[model samples]
Target: MDWPFSRRGLFQGAAVATGLAMASRGTAAPFDRLRQKNHPGWVIGHLTGAQAVAETLLAEGTGCVFGIPGAQENELWDELKARNVHYQLVTHEYSAACMADGYARATGTTGVLCVVPGPGVTNALTGLGEALLDSIPVVAIVGDVGNGEKARPFQVHSLNQVDLLKPVCKAVYSVCDVKQIPNAIRQAFQAATCGEPGPTAVVIPYNLLIEMADFRCPPLAEAGVPFDDAAFAQAVALLGDKRLRVGVYAGLGCMDFSGSLTAVAELLQAPVATSVSGKGAISDCHPLGVGWGYGPHASEVAEIAFAREKLHPHKSGIDVLLAVGVKFSEVSTGYYGNPRPKHVIHVDVNANNLGKAMPADVCVHADVGLFLGKLLTCGDTLRRPTDGHLLAKIRQAKADHEAKLKAIPAAKCGVDPLALVAALRRGLPEDAMLFTDVTASEHLAAESFRVTQPRTYFNPVDNQSMGWSIPAALGAQQAACGRTVAAMIGDGCFLMSAMELSTAAREGLPVKVFVLDDHAYHYMQMLQKAAYKRTTATELGRIDYRAFAQAVGVAYQEILVQDHLDAGIRSAVCHTGPVLVRVLTDYGDRKIRWIEAVRDRYAKELTPAQKARFASRIGYRTLSLKPEKSD
Candidate 1:
């Protein structure tokens, strides 16, 4: 074959083959990738900006990209297709951000989302904020208007996307040149995953994605967990004191180190309570594991387990709270409802967060896993004999918690709200990915629903973003390899993202969405009724759920009473396609412990004049209102 060509022609053909080989290196395996340490420069052929993003993403081990296509980044979509990079076209930009977040939560990797600027960026803000506050890693690739020589005064879909993304992202990189695309995207992933994980955005102008450049940027080393040796020593001094009884309060940062966390808890003979986002960090079945929030406003089990000596004579309450990777946020703390311990050892990756929420006697700037590992390495000095009495007390509190849930009588109006949580807990699989919305039941789920595995349960805990679970479940379904992905959506929150069920149907993502149909924003009503002695602007319009389900092309199931609870959940979870299960919910006479505790704490903070104003208003409402309760 070679003999047929001239010497010059043979050399030319070899050069052409070499160029093709270089260009095709986009999909190279990890071993074949160039390393920055090796100083490999421009060994690959020139590539378009879109190709740079696609190749960089593949190199970084990101499996799928989630977002809708628009005018600004059509070329990028084409490149993604060419590279066989997986991408999901969500119904809305908001869902794109949320789905990416869901993917991140479900898979424990950096999730990617792509969208055009302005409205696309604005629509995704809430979801990004949720990821930011909840410490989930998500990478967003956004398209901006033309810059450089292609700069134009009036461009479509133009806005300050970089600034809009900043508050919600750990870092926002705006790429101006095609050469910077790969580095920026890689850096974006790094930013999202490093230290305190959060959303990170890469804003690339549309003009640059089509430009050609020789991309030689290799993947950077993933950042290691930060540690402060001096602070760690200080923290250990507090934790190692045998006289001080300890309780472990974990957060999302401890999700990856659940085994270590559990080990630390057992070694100290301590009770473990998690933040809202840290629900599944320790198995709820663990003897020492109490539920979310060790405070008056949180799980009753946690509250009792952490109560002072007066409450439990057999064992004194937590004298020292070893709060690891958790911030005592306002919502989690119920207006700082967490009782001040005799000693507080607060440790987190970010130094700025230490002692901000509640006062920390010793603040340690260290990684959750690293710190837990160090504690275990301290040998017999850090170990405490297992206290059988403490275990018995925790068991009793847990029993009481379960008994309380079971004793709640079925609602006379429709389905009992508490029953809904109980049924899902009973019906769902052990490994199911459960995503809950910002409803009153979120607190209930945090309390009554048991989570046994890390990353298996999620809620928009910090930002309290409504309607988050629907699309999030669908996104989890995409990343989930046959595990059940379900969402418990509030009646009010459902209206915000109900349309996303159609996305599930379109993509054949079998997400079981349970709509808690109360026909009102009962969470809001509970607050208003307590404060003002009445409710206003809390009622929600009801939709014909069966018809809506059919219109959305998903299987429909209705749980009208207690009889339908388990059967309905079973049917929906077993369905091979998307299913919308509507539970006719009545939150009648059920108390939200969180709201009650939060209310009491908030009232305690008010001034005398402020208290009188509230009291007078309530008194006037009681006297002037009609005999019948008014909306």
Candidate 2:
């Protein structure tokens, strides 16, 4: 029999995975490996495709797989469990994708999600889009309908999955033969983690999953960050200017290099700011850390610290902005209001993102880790004596900001959103994983939340996918056992993903999900009331969340008054299983500064006629409302 394994391919793939490592991780040696080539990488095995799939996943260091198995993928799902590879069954396909995303973000490793074809692919698209835009590494293993020699048209759950996924995935691979399954899956992992990471899809026909074939799947080396020597030379030369007032704007790309980032910041004597997704890349407690964003749309502390006039008598706010690993997305930049300083040194792993948001004096296409690492090599040239004045300004701004945050209290009706967020910040573990959804409180949390480590805080900023936090928290909890994981979800967002809470309860993931119960889509209400002078269709049904929690087989806690805040958090944290915590929230007369800044920038872009129309509508609506008849 002619061997189906390729000799050329075996030599080309992998640094290699140790058998001892696989054993330690509880994965049994591959199901049926009858013969192996001279090279250990090539495991020529007479096994079903499902066995091949499970073996590859274990080798790739995937701790858990999140998805709902269906008819098309049942065989593969069974194989995964047979090998002792942990798999969590989610309630919805969308939640599966979100969970995978959460796992990837929290653990800084690739997340895997498996689903059947057609509806499964469609249902998971939104989560994939979120992952893609947020630069998350997720591998979506989708099972396609049979396309063997006798393949027929119009098969059940059969659609052009590859085309459907292309919009949301970084790359998509369609496997034809059973022998190709291992390489296809391995390549998916490589694609998912390479450079600017995002979701990658590997489509395997269900027929192939059950077919027996000889396999030669050798895992490939994980992708490494790019380093351009000449670009580093150019960047170093720019930083060598001792007279330049430098400021650092870091992003998610700088996550793995936080230590290097901190070193470079101290050397440059620069204040550091981050994008929303980039929060926690530097410890917010760090003296040099000014908080997220560095313009009018940013934190007041960041705005003040970056203001040249505030720090110096005559110099500009930031003479040179060292922006790394962050894109100026509309949400993060507040309609691109983030500063475009005189000399912008924008560096990123993804070349496409560089120089597109803000014009750059020097654009460096390199991984943030590699770039920061190179900077440390010539630390002396970039080193500057610490400026007492700059440090004093940042310290004062932070102190005042903290004082302001501490002084705010909940309004009469319910807990103030920021007050709740601040309480959680104080009560939760310093190293806890916090995920926030798209809501008014998200902005409030961004302003007041204190994060001490990289990848500790996450938000659906660019995608603005409501209800993302619930599943995301559970997903992260699955990967991060023993660490606390929490989600601050709005009442409206809670409704969108309320079913997913049951998945956590079933899987026993201890994720404290807090529902900011305002009895309405208050985030939308705020936006609409400002634009239309009256809210429409923003109200949500008042839910008896305690009862809902009982139905879902989880512990329930509610923080109605300000007095119960600490006790409520403690109860949830101490609970053994998943807990749903509800905080009655009031956004009355509270301001989300990010929203205000975005609205202001948007208003400036409105034509005079457009403004007049809005004004006319507001006037008409205000005049049309009749006074209530008092008895």
Candidate 3:
């Protein structure tokens, strides 16, 4: 579609359609004229406290505030509910933050979240970090005690709130002046969504929310424009080198700039891949499209295939890596094992991450979607796809992985990871939104499943936090009305937010949760098995997941093998309410020896500096393990 806010169309429409007809005879400031002629007797409401801030927040399009409501935030919650803004009561503050983060990631807007001061805020740090790293805009409105003895005691109880978040947020402001609430809301929105979007925090005093006052919202024009074009153009040229066999990697940012990415990719015809977080950024079936590669598991295959000749359809081979709206974390580049063919071009809204790990050959700091639009104009030409011979090699490399997946055998209690993923892929409804929690199961699903659309596949990749899938799916299901939301989580991930099933049941959200019951942190267990040659605390006693779901008043069933998966999913979907399908699987011995050999060959003999660099890579911490080997 047309750019959401086309400057030319906006300028033309304003000038031609309403310029003369709406113009005043004499020159006067628009705000001044509005305050006098059109807005006569329009008294500006003075919000005295926190409840008033909630009222103003409600006025500004926030439908719900996700949080673990407590004594400190009760007044604000009461007022928010009174204003008809729903409260997404969650099990933990982090899960609540994650729910909002997931919603914002999918919707490209500031997700509103509320939390009590101290413990509550601290609990949400993980989610906040995830949102920051992924460039997902979310507004964290925390209720802090006012400047008094209680505030000092609060400080002692809490890690310095703003200090704790400084590294992970766009900005943090304490709301003191009652009148500043509206501006604070606007600033929080701007901070969360501006160039290199991320979460922002606005601390409001706990006692102030109950204070009475009138609230007035600022006009839309006064909300400040997002980005500047001149600055954006400079950023676009950073990756505009013609000699560079540019591999355009996109993420969630491309979903917002859909046409811009298509325009730019069509012009360059470069091989494109989407990060898992940006799954729907481009059509996965397209010739130019390469699948998600942001972790060691797949990155090893991608690195080898990309480095060798004629791997992808665009065989030109990535002489220059141009990542747009994509976070180039260590995982994004295979723990830095994926050697750059030439220059690496990194474009993002966050300046902090521009050159953090895999420093870009050319770093362009600007709004991802905006810069993408400008890049389309800057590079306008349809070029041929790169080296053709490489395509066959990539196919062979991927086929090798597929063969390994097929060899995995099912265990008595725990199912094969590949079989579980295949079952979910085939069993779920066509339009279902699939969400994978952090575990070996997610890696299995990521490798085997094909994501047809972007937002339909959800995972907290930037932070890779555990326990995010179920709550995130709940939030997404609320956003996707009648459509199905299938959350594939591990046993641990389910425990983290399983209690929130009460909230799901209360809200009547129709989401199907497929709990991959491995009975431990499978990812960690895999690593331990690979490195330490055994397992310890990684294992846990079995709990009846069916009883747990029934206790929460939702439907539940057990699926022990691939044959039973389809029926279990169909039953869950037919229930018209929340359903939890627990799929029991063994830690079946299915080792990915090929991957281990690849990494061991290059990584085992690395120099100290190279090793240190590798350690600092994203997702590298978990590189000690390889998949189990059935053969």
Candidate 4:
């Protein structure tokens, strides 16, 4: 046993030497020698295990990471900080996921989120579901217990975390080996941004994160494939067929696509209809921009009908519909059946969406901006609205629709949802963001508010899930500091996520929640009355919302009249932290126009008297706002 110069000593010496070699610059280890150059981007790294994962994130150009680094995954946090990457500590895991989604929605790039186990995964589920439905690109790197050693049953740190997330994620990767982390991250990114676009999950075990690194992965940034040029040419050629009446349907994807949106409008002299998400994608005042995506009132109906005729197939007054980046959904399209237009040409980044149900005669799985730009530059057959009579018909349709939307008179105790939305729009800044939940409250907001900027309106309309408004607004507030963030939730949706206001308060995020207190889901009531002709399970029990707000230590307000609306909004905006404004409403009886429109459109043969009665009840009326007390 003299000096014990054994194999163990030699192994220890080699480990130290390897560590030193890794620390030295320009020293190529076996893993480094095997690293692939010219793979995707100029940025490359030789990393393995948890360090490799961190290096992969850096390679992907992720400037910021929104998450709380828990005890189990502090190593990842340390590595991120070491690389000078910014980390935002969101109030909760759900907020972290939503914050990333909002960032991606605003920036048009994939966002990154990190979370711990069990509850963390559950908390993030809602936002991830929303991203999946909306075709947003987001990546969630969740931490798990490495090596699967659990002292107790159902422990949070189990390796089965990837399996837990598989149902909701676009793709799930359980990295078991230290060397596989880099490629796993790259695949996660690809799954998120490629094809239909959605969220992907990469689960890293805590034990694995601490393992020694063998290599680093380089960033996989590269120019996306060129837009389908042949499709562009075909679209241009189809538009040139003067035999067809071509109309352009625009979506949010076209907001910054000045070249393409403008060129297509000018070339085809076709009016443009935008989805709610596409509000302001094209200038509302633009001559070619007809109106919004679907009909909420007469204005929308008239605009859509006018647009349909101009783009109908067979060039028979309306022959072709060039829909761009519009994810035609039920609410956006008034729940009426989406009639396939003649020669339907759909161009969207999500290829899976192009031929969905309503088959597209010309499906261009390309970016709207890129494809439109090329078509505008190469195609020369598009023209202005040369037919004066046709333009007038379109104008008349819009005017009639607006008049219908204006007809619903508000009862003495009821508030006009549209007017409230208009007030919010008027008082808010151009760049201010508004978050809203599904239900009648959102419908009114969409109908009345006119957004002209990106990230100006944030509605969780994708999954059509309730209780998303409050947390989503908190996420937005965290992501966009110093900007006004407000969530407009119905009495029903408000109650679901209202408890999270405590988190908002603790985080010092100044998010205002406006509760439309109508004592029920008014939209459901309206639908029941129209369809089933009865109200059931739509009423809500009364509670002191102001008291609830006060208990949460948030500024509280209860407004019952139009005169108090502006003051309340201004006061909330000036508050330092969270505020809850309960605007008592009686929209319970207000009629939803889309439902009425559908009824009238599909009414069967009727007698002279029946026809007269239907026509009289078909028109819209404005609901007048009045002062009232909470009885």
TM-scores for the candidates: 0.93, 0.92, 0.80, 0.79
Superposed Cα deviation of residue 61, candidate 3 (Å): 1.5
List candidate 4 stretches off by more than 4 Å: 1-64, 67-71, 74-92, 148-159, 221-223, 255-259, 294-317, 385-411, 529-536, 541-543, 551-553, 574-577, 595-631
User: How does model 4 fare in lDDT?
Assistant: 0.70
Candidate 1 residue-wise lDDT, 320-420, digit = tens: 99999998887888778888888899999988899998898888998888899999998577889988888988999999888876776878978888888
lDDT of 2: 0.86
Error of 1 at 58 (Å): 0.9
lDDT of 4 by residue, 1-631 (tens): 5676889999999999987875553233444544544354322344435566666786677756777788667878877776667667766677677777767765667788999887788878887888887767889998887564433555555546777788778999988777678778888888887756689999887777766654645545553753777887787788788777776767666766745686677677676777666666765545555556534342353245444443443322446888888767655666544455668888988777786746778888797767786776655466645655555665666566456445645546746666567668767777788888887767666655656665577667668767777876776676678988888889888766677787777778788888888888776777655544346788788979878877777878777876666788888888888888888776645565555665555554467887677555433211224322211
Ranking by TM-score: 1, 2, 3, 4
| Deviating ranges (above 4 Å) for candidate 1 | 1-43, 311-314, 625-631
For residue 541, model 1's alpha carbon misses the true position, in angstroms, by: 1.7
Clashes of each: 0, 1, 26, 30
lDDT of 1 at 101: 90
Clash tally for model 4: 30
Candidate 1 lDDT (Cα, 0 to 1)? 0.87
Clashing pairs in 1: none
Model 2, C-alpha of 173: deviation from truth (Å): 0.1
